[model samples]
Target: MRGLTAGYGPVRALDGVDVTAERGHITAVLGANGAGKTTLLRTISGLVRPTAGSVHVDGTDLTAAAAEKIARAGVAHVPEGRGVITELTVEENLRLGALLGSARKRTERTAEDVYTMFPALAERRRRDAHTLSGGERQMLVIGRALVSGPDVLLLDEPSLGLAPRIVSQIFGMLRDLVRETELAILLVEQNARSALSIADVGVVLGLGRVVATAPAAELAADDALRHAYLGF
Candidate 1:
């Protein structure tokens, strides 16, 4: 997304934000509450309308397109909450995501492929979604998104409220997925340190604007930046 600007009513949640997520890499978006992290992903995925700027996946312009159209373009978003259907079984929810992905080549990814990536979900494939634990639910949502075989995956607050061990495992798997599949991942996390630890690059947002964009290592090493914007 370049020069992306968006908000609700008159409030500008994002202001002149320019960002990129490359294939085979993970770009982490770090910020405090209300710093436009969620807005960035929403605008890119067409959930929130952009007041200005353009959103593109590859060379195709997706600026202000409908959410369904964007999804068909192979840009999948897994929002903050683990939003699996409580009434459906694990495999049922996974199939729904594939269907939501539109008429993409289904052979690109399968329920078995998702099961391989997340064995925990595979274990309870027939169980109700609500019966899974918090960490398991997080895995399920991510796996569901992956079933679409998206070129770019937008994740919002993936680590929110999870235990440290589970967070580590999930983040590590994301890193492996990017390396192996050459998938571009845009990760939004309030856990700045953890996000930077696994990210190839980091973008810091402050009050509806981008404060800095740098290599994750450089941002992690900057004490002043960490203290001021990251609050770590």
Candidate 2:
């Protein structure tokens, strides 16, 4: 994204934001509640249209593309809500993800891979999503997105309402996924410490724009910045 801008009526949510999520790496976006982190993901996923600038994936301009078009281009967004269909069974939800973009061809095989990645889901494949715990729900949503076979994965506030151990487990899996599968991840998180722990790059947003962009360790080591903006 370069000079990306998006808004809701009179209030601008994303103001001239510039960032990148490289393949085989994790780029974390950290900020306060209203710091435009979620908006950035929405814009890139086509949930919200940009008022200005450009969004490119694998060198293709997706600035004005529709949501489906963006997904077809290999961008999968797991929004803040954990987006599980409560009425659907675990396997059914996983199958839903396979319908999006290019993953449509290998739904069964991908579902098996997702079950392998998330053994808990495999154990409860016949249960409705509403019956799962918070951590299980989070895993289901992420596994759903993974089966889509996207090149870029955008995660929004994935650590919300989860235990520290569960968060660590999920983040650890993300690190392995990036290294083994070479997929790029753009993670928007409020858990600055955990996010930075696995990130290759970290981008800090304040108000509606970026205030800092640096390697993960550098950002984590910045005491002043952490105390002021990251609350760590």
Candidate 3:
């Protein structure tokens, strides 16, 4: 995205934001609460229309595209709050993700890939979604998005409401996935330390604007930056 600007009535959530997610790499967006991190993801996913600028995926201009069109264009967004349907079974939720594309060939390929990556999901396929733990629910939501076969995965707050061990396990799985699938990930996270640890690149946002953009190692090593901006 270039010069992206968005708002909600009088509240300007994003202001002239320029960001990029390189293919086959993890680019993490880090910020405190209400720092426009979620808003940026929503704008890219077409949940919120940008007042200015453009979003391009693999040179395709998606600024004017609808949310579904963007999803079909291989940009899958797992929004904040883990949008899992409590009434659905684990397998049903996975199938719902397959419906995002609806092409028989693509759906079959995505389902096979998702189940392969998330073997635990296959084990609990018959269980009700609500019966799963918080970490399991998160995995289900992520697995659902993966079943869409997106080129870029937009993850919002993956570490929220999970135990430390579970968080590490999920992030470790993500690291392995990036290496194995070569899928780009744009991670929006409040867990700055952990997020930066695993990310290839880091973009820090403050009050609707980017404060810093650097390699993850650089950001982690900068004590002043971590203490002031990341509260670490």
Task: Give all candidates' CA lDDT scores.
Answer: 0.91, 0.91, 0.87
- Candidate 2's displacement at residue 29, Å, is 0.1
The candidate with the higher lDDT, 2 or 3, is 2
- TM-score order of candidates, top first: 1, 2, 3
Q: How many backbone clashes does candidate 2 have?
A: 0
Per-residue lDDT of model 3, residues 25-101, tens digit only: 89999988878999999999999999999999889899989998899888889987878998999989988887885
Error of 3 at 99 (Å): 1.4
- TM-score per prediction, in order, is 0.97, 0.96, 0.94
Instruction: Give a tens-digit lDDT track for model 2, residues 54-148.
Output: 99998989999999989977888999988899999999999888887454222233878877877888999999999999999999999988888
RMSD of 3: 1.9
Prediction 2 TM-score vs. true: 0.96
Worst 10 residues of 2 by lDDT: 100-109
lDDT of 1 at 135: 95
Candidate 1: how large is its RMSD? 1.3
| lDDT score for residue 221 of model 2 | 100
